[model samples]
Target: MRTPPPRVLTVAGSDSGGGAGIQADLKTMLALGTHGMSVVTAVTAQNSLGVQGAWPLPAEAVRAQFRSVVDDIGVDAVKTGMLASAELVETVAALLDEVTAPVVVDPVGISKHGDALLAASARDAVRTKLLPAATVATPNLDEVAWLTGVQVASETGLRRAADAILSYGPRWALIKGGHLEGDAVDLLTDGSEEHWLRAPRHDNRHTHGTGCTLASAIAAGLAKGCSVPEAVRAAKTYVTGAIAAGFALGAGIGPVDHGWASPCRQPKVSPSGV
Candidate 1:
């Protein structure tokens, strides 16, 4: 009999376009050699063009899915995205506190095509409830501004952004500086220690699922037992390749290639922590 791989669970919305959200997380997990599981928090009428409609699941429904997965199969790590509303955010946050595994929270605020994935009322829930339960909280530039009122205009502002996010109580704060010019840089810190992850910017415009893909990749790494800095560095490497290999899909922006690193056996990450 074959040995089962490490299990990783994603609690996020589903993208009908098969690009971001639950779809991206599963794809990334499989590519990274982990068993992927999911608890879909919502379903979106999304395409490469944009998110047309989104309906969040009830708090009870979300709870049932999480319980079903963790109760039987068990999980080595968990990642969250696009909780949609305050009820769902609070619900998932409460659920996470009971788990023994590490949690990666991608405080998804907006879609690639400028659609809001999180409600304004839910922002408080993310900062207070959701973030406090996370092992690592991954937030992009725009998310930094809206979540903590820290407007990061250049690379120099990433530290301030990380500091603001760390105050919310996550064990580690990964401030994605992907929206900045020049290099694609990110800051990973846990108050005392820091690691600056930098990759050459890919000139690909079809990089739609960047945030979800990166956060999920980080969770996959954690499931496989990589330390916070190690997991994040490897995830950054994986996402950089994905962005570089992004292909044109529909008339609008497309998704990062979640499978792009598989062929090279490139992720080759070292196992370390939760």
Candidate 2:
């Protein structure tokens, strides 16, 4: 009866666990008042204990799924995660090049339990192909080290990390400093302007989907026409609440609460408001 909301798409693996990957991305989009779509790049046999196994889809299949949504339904923004191989990375990056939507590239390399998601061989493709096409590249401390070889020990290294990330060609870089010793701090910069986002470090361990959720939330905000800094700030607020409310799922590290921003379903405000 009314116009559809801004459409956001996640191109990532399927987490059978439902705490991360495509599941978390879609949940975050809905929580942020955006329509969610998916283009699965891989499938993981996983649970809270750990990832048991993973299998990447054919590159053509990834391409087709992306086209199926983009050609007919269209999209306002896109987020990418857990691309398993160099081929898939290049494929998704190429698809990103063809679209005008703002892209949030989460260079997802490892799982919460230390399982490798992106192949080591694929790192090069992600840096040259994927990162170059992103509107904002979101990488945690560990991811930043592997992708940029710059190990950040404290808050001071955040600016250095952002510089390394921006050299990859993203319009903006969000260097997630969650692993730092003190308060959870992050650095966002576009070489000229900078926004240092900090939040109290919530003492919670069930943060399995933090990367995917934050990146997707940023995408959702961008879809609603927020600027890069605006989208990232709002995403930080949402994820901070999520981490604080995280609950135990299985015998191991659990997941952040994607619906933490919404206690219960409230009446829609506007098509663009979350």
Candidate 3:
């Protein structure tokens, strides 16, 4: 008999540019050896430039998609991003209540091109409804400020931000501090112990999908049977490599190379060790 692949699902928006959101999530999952599935909550006319327009799907449609996937195919882990509205957030949260897998929540508030994806009205829904259901909540610096009113200027400030996010009831909080100067550092905590993740800054402009990609990668790790901290550590390493191997495609910021493994951009080694 053939072995089954680890299954992972991404609940997010569709990016026309295919560099972020659902596109990036799926790419990351495939590269990390998992079967990727999606339930798109919104569609956006986006590119490396910016978001031109957006249309959010109805709550019924969102709920139906979640049921279709969860009831049959059965996900091992689920990652959510870009819900766009409070109604959609609540709907997803309620649907998640029925899912048995671990949940990775990337509170996608703004895009790499500086377009707002989640609305100001929906912040409360994300905080009260969606976040509490998360196995781990991944939020970048801007989103940290948006959700908790705390600014992470230095590495030490990540604790305060993590505490505020933990108050929402997620088992773990992964606060991404890539926006800070010098090294790209992230903080992971469970309201008690703290894990400070530090990596050398790649100085790459093609980091368009870092948040979504990292969350999805972590979900993929969980689906493959890794613990939360182990998954996070692996994801951080993977994303750093992706960023280091990133390429410029469009006129604006491109995306981190999800296919950082298996000789996509880098040269492949032969059996002869050449």
Candidate 4:
């Protein structure tokens, strides 16, 4: 019999566009060589344009789905995104607390088009409950500003942002500086050790599911037994390649190509190293 791949469970909302949310999480997991599972917390009528409608599932339904997977399947890592309401955030946090696996919280607050994915009231719940259960909390600059009052104007502000996020109790905080001007920079810290991840900002405007993809990629790395920094480094490399290969999808913004790691998509080099 063949050995099974590492298991990763994503607890998030469903994106009708198949770009962000649960869709992106599973895609990232599979691309990173993990067995991905999901527990849908909400269903959104969304596309590249924007979210048309969103309906959060009941807390019981969310709990049931989590139990069904975790009790039997037993995830090696978990990634969370788009907890729409305060109740849902707390419920998921409680369930995550019971799981022994490492958890990666995306802390998704808004969509690619500036639409809110998380309820404003749930911010506190995320800080107080969800964050404590996270091994890593990945938040973009906008999310950092939303969760913490610090507005990241430059790379200097990233440390403050990471510190603020670390105060919430996650083992590590990854403050993404993609929204800033110039190269994309991200700061990962655990209130002690720090890693600054920088990548050349590809001028791709179709990076719709970057946050979800990165977080899920990190979870997949952790599930495969990588250290935190090693996992983050691998995830950054994967997401950077995905962003570079992003292509146009629907009428509006598109999604990063999750299949960028496939052999056919690999960049070809000349024998003369041209």
Q: Give the top-scoring candidate (TM-score).
A: 4
Residue ranges of candidate 2 with Cα displaced over 4 Å: 264-274
lDDT of 4 by residue, 1-274 (tens): 9999999999999999999999999999989899999999999999999999999999999999999999998999999999999999999999998989999999999999988989999999999999999999999999998998889899999999999999999999999999899888899999999999988888678888989999999999999999999999999988888888887898999998898868887523211112
Candidate scoring better on TM-score of 2 and 4: 4
Tens digits of per-residue lDDT for model 1, 133-174: 999999999999999999998989999999999999999999
Q: Which regions of candidate 1 fall more than 4 Å away from where they truly are?
A: 264-274
* Model 4 segments more than 4 A misplaced: 267-274
Q: List the residue pairs that clash in candidate 2.
A: none
Q: Point out the worst 10-residue segment of candidate 2 by lDDT.
A: 265-274
lDDT of 1: 0.92
CA lDDT of every candidate: 0.92, 0.91, 0.91, 0.92
Residue 98, candidate 2: alpha-carbon lDDT: 90
By lDDT, the better pick of 2 and 3 is 2
lDDT of 2 by residue, 1-274 (tens): 9999999999999999999999999999999999999999999999999999999999999999999999999999999999999999999998998999999999999998889999999989999999999999999989999998999998999999999989989999999999988888899999999999988877678888999999999999999999999999999988888887777898988998887756473222211223
Query: TM-scores of all models?
Result: 0.95, 0.95, 0.96, 0.96
Clashing pairs in 3: none
In angstroms, give how far residue 177 of model 2 lies from its true place.
0.3
